[model samples]
Target chain A: MSTILECKNLSKAYGGKTALSHVSLSLNGGHIIGLLGPNGSGKTTLIKLINGLLTPSEGSLLVGGHPVGVESKRITSYLPDQSYLNANLKIKEIISYFDDFYNDFDKARAYDMLEKLSIHPEAKLKTMSKGTKEKVQLILVMSRRAKLYILDEPIAGVDPAARDYILNTILSNYEEDATILISTHLISDIENILDEVIFIKDGQIVLNSSVDKIREENGKSVDSLFREVFKC
Target chain B: MAWNLNSDRPIFMQLIEIIQISIISGKYAPGSKLPSVRDLASEAAVNPNTMQKALAELERSGLVFSQRTSGRFITEDVAMIEDLKSTLAKEKMKQFLESMRQLGFQKEETLALMSKFLKGDHS
Candidate 1:
């Protein structure tokens, strides 16, 4: 298996607060890796670093064997935990923007997904509900045929039915050779789909392993082990 | 086909078992086309990755074969499914016999329980 992403001693800080500290990890192609941590545990920071939205204060990140930069951004599709689209834009306008910017973006798939969600292309982002907006954002990000997908809290704050929909969309849209790194604290819901998991706490990696190896070695499900390791 | 899932087991493993049972029962007949991974995932309300893993496992066991663009299909080899069924059946019977023996049941009592259960007019 070829390495799709590699991070070496990555560190990030905001003023006096440390969001990540010397984190090192590598992901292979075709992996659905779960990035797990509690609140303030640096999950978002790590994702941002990988997405090149924020440069690491120290260390290096290589996406598809290239350093994090404009080139890396082209091959990386990101879905932030919160909506980042302008509220004034219509759903169709946002799709056009993605189509123009991302060479790999599939406009037909995005439209198909929107239709499935019953979202009208003429609907304004400002007028839609929070959950609806989130769904739209997800549809846009997932329609891109990027080599790496960095999804932060994809299912957070959604109802159970919508959560299932979001997860299903992710599964259906991702390319076979791509690597999807989903950051979430919702372990139980995603524990089954994950091929590998990297647990972060206090700005540091605490556990990282393939799901099969973890289950075989620990004799416990990933959810149970997460509860044990991150017990409060 | 519906799966008899155990909460204790992982969903993907249960999915593999369900597909195997389908093969055994001829619901997914030999050489017949199996459902797309996306369709199966949607039907089961599971992540596509989970379904993909199950399909991959099936492929490894020679119980299913994929044709790239055409999608996955049940393997034409009936022996593979029969082998899996026999292995699983033997393991299950072993556990049942062990439990009965631990409960102080002799061979005669075990036979009696089987006969009594089989004779019932189950609706």
Candidate 2:
């Protein structure tokens, strides 16, 4: 399979603190990969580098064989951990904005998903509850037919039911040819669907392997192995 | 019918065994429909994706057949179910015997424990 994203010796630092340090990883098409790490482990930083939200302090990131830039952005759909939308905009307006920005954005599918979630398109972002807004954002990101979907902490801070809905939405949406990279610390919940896992710690990759191989070799659940490796 | 299973072995393999057991025990007769994916997932409290994977494995093994709109059903071949049950039982028995030997339990003592456990007497 072709490599969807490749990071070579990527590093990002803010003032004297390092967020990511010489981290090298690659994602291939048609894979749902878990980007797992504890808080302050640079999971968000790595995702930012891939999405070109932040220029790497050193090294490089390539998406779909092109360097991270305008061209790469076109093929990548990013869902940041925080809400990036303007609170004043209505849900329908948000969908229109995505439609204008992305060529592959599927407005019909977005509306379908909203209908499933019972989200009112006329409701403004400022009016919806935080969890509802998160669901809306997730629906929009997942509705895009982009080559790579970079989801940062997709299920974080949500109730268990909402988490299940978000995860199921991800599993049901997205083209078979596309790749999904989900960055989160909830390893156990998402462990089954992941084809591969990239474990990041202290701004570096400590383990990256297929889920089946990890289970076969370690004879333990990925969550258990994670605890053993990154235990405090 | 849904199978209740808890084993240290891999879940997918255990699922296969459970399906075979259901067949051998006549819980799922030939031509009978199996539980839907969603139902099975909720019953097991496992990810639907994991349940789908196990079902796909069963379909590939020719032990189950799926109709796109109608859902999956058990195969009509009883011999296949019998073969699966015998193979799995032998494997599990071998492992149990090996563990007993390693624990230094002689055959007579092992039979005695089995009898007491089966008879519900703990004296």
- Number of backbone collisions per candidate, in order? 0, 0
TM-score of chain B of each: 0.82, 0.74
Question: What digit string (tens of lDDT, one per residue) describes model 2 on residues A103-126?
Answer: 999999999999999999999999
lDDT of each: 0.86, 0.85
Worst 10 residues of 2 chain B by lDDT: B1-10
lDDT of 2 by residue, B1-123 (tens): 224543223556666666677787898898899998756655554445457778999899998999989999999998888888898889997898889989999888888887998999877
lDDT of 2 at B92: 90
TM-score, candidate number 2: 0.80
Q: How does candidate 1 fare on TM-score?
A: 0.87
Model 1 over residues A128-214: C-alpha lDDT tens digits?
887888899899999999999999998887887888788878877899889999998888777666778999999999999877667
Please give the lDDT score at residue A161 for candidate 1: 83
